[model samples]
Target: MKTLTAGRLLPVLGTLLAALLCALGPGAGSASAHAALTSTDPASGSVVPAAPRQVKLTFSEGVLLSADSVRVLDPQGRRVDESKPAHADGKSNTAVVGLAGGIADGTYTVAWQAVSADSHPVAGAFTFSIGAPSKTVAEVTTAEAGPVVDALYTTGRYAAYAGYLLLVGGCVFAGVCRSSRPVQRIAVGGWITLFAATSALLLLRGPYAGGKGLGSAFDLTLLGDVLATKPGAALLSRLLLLSAAAVFLAVLFGSYAREDGDRTRMERRDVAYGLAIGGTVVAVGLAATWAMAEHASAGLQSWLAMPVDVLHLLGVAVWLGGLAALLAALWSGEPVRRAEVQRFSRLAFASVCVLVATGLYQSWRQVGSWGALTGTEYGRWLLLKVALVAGMVVLASFSRRWTGRLTDGRPAPKKQAPAVRAVQAATGAAKAARPSRKDKDASPERAAQLARQREALEKAAGRRQRDADEGRSGLRRAVLAEAGVAVVLLAVTTLLTGTQPGRAETEQRQSAASGGARTTAPAASGPAETRIPYDTGGTNGRGTALIRIDPARSGNNSIDVSVTDPAGKAVDVPELEVSFTEKQKNIGPLRTALKRTSAGRWQATGFQLPMAGTWQLTLTVRTSDIDQITEIRNVKIN
Candidate 1:
């Protein structure tokens, strides 16, 4: 029983080690062409004097122009822009749209929608004033910047998938073929490979996702940002945890392997220790994969999403890793162990069931539509992956059937006796030619006994040879089929990682709608009404200021603003500047000043409130724009 368990466990342990090593190695998909917005013209919050001739946007990669839309809206929420967006001349990253007349003085918003190169829809808005220059608003909003993060996140995610597949396959093979030393060696090599691969992946992940070149990848700032992001934190945490787990397991396995004299105790310890280590390693691997794929290591959803992601990863590892073990089992010429094979098969089947269920749920969340499966590059690649997985299942089914037959322990049929006899005769001739010195006994009784023993040995050899031939043939076929399926699935998975899933059609429709509205607007007319109200409730009078600026038409213009104190006296304002806040930097200046109007009501003409926001009006009634009076206000134009 001890030997039997060892036979079942050693190969699996070796394969597990391989998976760890491979996960640490250098990864595939080094190209950093994932979709990302780089910059925008009339930046997020700029107070332009006139409606610009055109608005321009740039991205990290060449954008798909047909699936992008840009709109210019007046303070009244009316669309004001005549030109449809056109691909910028000689620039794939830039998209430009010509503006129409009637863009009045006040605040104006430029709303944009685009499909990334990977087919994900990203939309956002920026504001630029025509006349009065208010504060600078950032060109990139959180929503706009989402694509860049998503792209980076996805890249790490798919690399993780590849790593998981490789590791699991290696471990499974090692576990099942423990009887053969050569097989054990291969399994050990696999462990080394997985560890190396995973380590490389960790290194690559930092630079690849953080938008940095390899040279400065380890810089403190870059590392800081990487550490802060969902994928980076997850990778770092899981890598450390897994490495520790692997080392501990290795030590335990070595200790168990060395106690050969006490076979019974050693065998029991080996099973217990192997399971403890293997289970830990498996858990870590699952966690790491989930961390990368689901960004499960970050934020409020981390508790729930992380565990679900871990389970999904675990299911994948068990199924793929178990397949690797089955492959190793088939590689050994020894008769397949029926009970062990059955146990692994059952586990593999259960893992596959879990994988499918979890995978479908995840797909629904990510893909969103049936059209996405074919309409988007990501969808198509995913479909291909599904097809390949189906093929693997068919191959697995065939393997299970053959495994059942091999385990039945039935003798060769009478119809196949002739072939068996031929093999026996060949083995007999070989043995006769290589006779042992002990077989040279000359006494009659001893000679008769020797002959009987030789005959028995010959029969045993024949049976072993017949079993070897049959096992090899069936295993070879099964292995080849499995390999084919694995290759196809790997290819599909690789492509899926490279593509983005979403609708190209929807983007175009939105762009067209935005374009048609631009043609109906008139030209800008006057300074319009720009009202700046201060919220002086908080300490240091640090409350939001509500600034309402109505851009009557679409072109550029400016307005004036003034503030009166509670005493109904005109206040000399200082330290007043405007800016927009978001993930990326884009802010404009509040250049115009308030002039004395009638009595307590002072007015500043040519004041521009670019984008809608809770603008902070900093004033030092008697000093500079940085000291003294500080007031914040929330203002919505349209």
Candidate 2:
């Protein structure tokens, strides 16, 4: 029982793995492209030293200005930035926002949306305070997307990918390698699945992007919005490519399936040639849709990256999908030729080499560093994909060994078992009826001849059973196992497609290093956040001023001030200055010149406090050209 279980384990595992692969392939079609916020002039959560002329944003990739939108508002939700389309600077990913008028003191929120170079739409918002944050009416209302909607979107994408592979693999397998009924069926199914998946994704995009629930997937209004974008356009292109592929597939299957191969060899050869040329062209066009709508067309070196990604997709389809076809042929209750297996094996090897070369380039481009492989979600999934593919390669080598057995003449033993059983029956009966068995040599009586014949038949049947069962190698088991592991690899590949790339972190860190206060003196790092409010008396009367100190607590801090009326209305004060004194340490007053950022905001940076203690800060508020009032406040630092 142990031996039998051990012998069948690999094949059982293979079948199960294929099933899991089928399950995994559909969800792997998550957004291949993801956009990360790189940097803004006033960093997210950074208190600027002063209000700026304009808000500048730099992303990791060049984006579509028309499809992207940006908005900036003060604490009162009054639009401070111009309400118009944002534009990208020449050759740079930076988007510039023109200020509508002067900005006042308070927390300001910048909400933005962009269609990245990879054609995926992404959005986010961030806040920066002036003197301090006020009761800002601004909110990040888009909120977290529903999990069900996300899952459905991802599943639809993966389904399309799976369908693409099946259709493409079936063509390569049937046209060039060998023809089989089961392979054709798989190819046909692939076409249908691809069509369905594309339709579903096209409909789902609008709702998903709008942050609507799963139930809104069928919203026609949203669908129209999706069709107007790049992702939708890519999917539409894929459908057209699939339609062309269907025509080629029909021709190949029809010609190859005819029984009179010898009589119409030339016609079939022409069809095969057509498949090699036309099919590849169609496959490349189809693959381009994915690449253009994915990471390959975004971020760094997009032009060169796109071609590599297209090849990578094609290689994967041939290798992984071919394995699936091989499994079908093997279990088709017909002889699988050594020639067929060897042919596929060679092609599969070349495909794998291409996959490796392209995959390495992609990994380097997306991950950026070795640490990111473990540090980022995308990296971790890539690791899993590599490990699974490695396991499948090992299993495939074992299956290849089984294919070699076809030439070793091992199958002859089962064929000869019946002939050997007939001879055994005659010999056994003669021996049982001999005189030597009954007396000394045992001779059998004529009256018991029928019983002796029956005993001999039983003995012969048992011997034949042993012969037929014995030495029947687990070749089927190896193939099944190989197929199963390959399927799992496809699933892992799907997951990697949907994950966020690690390169995003590398870009963001670099952007942070060069932004805002981080570029100056001891202010190389942002100051801690602290907001202090005080009212300056006059006709601008009892208004609240918010003070923001970056790295606010100790060391070097950058100061910003925002003045607003009690009700949070902008009050453009004329002149404002701040002085810091560490009184307990007997430190003299250190005055920093204020730079006007906007009408209500002032910035002063690069003031280093030598010690940690309670510091007295004085704000000289000039309401008019002549009248100035001083407001004093104490701030503790450690």
* Model 2, position 107: C-alpha lDDT score: 72
516 in model 1: Cα distance from truth in Å?
8.7
Task: List residue ranges in candidate 2 displaced over 4 A.
Answer: 1-33, 42-54, 64-68, 77-82, 89-92, 96-104, 129-133, 260-264, 407-410, 413-473, 513-638
lDDT of 1 by residue, 52-125 (tens): 78889875444444312677766556666677777788775678887776556766667665544332334445
- Give the winner by lDDT: 2
User: How do the residues 240-309 of candidate 2 rate in per-residue lDDT, one tens digit apiece?
Assistant: 8888988887877885466664656787677667668998899899899988887887766778889999
TM per prediction:
0.49, 0.65
What C-alpha lDDT, on a 0 to 100 scale, does residue 516 get in candidate 2?
Answer: 29
Cα lDDT, model 2, residue 238: 85
Q: What is the Cα-based TM-score of model 1?
A: 0.49
Q: In candidate 1, what residue range of length 10 has the lowest lDDT sum?
A: 550-559
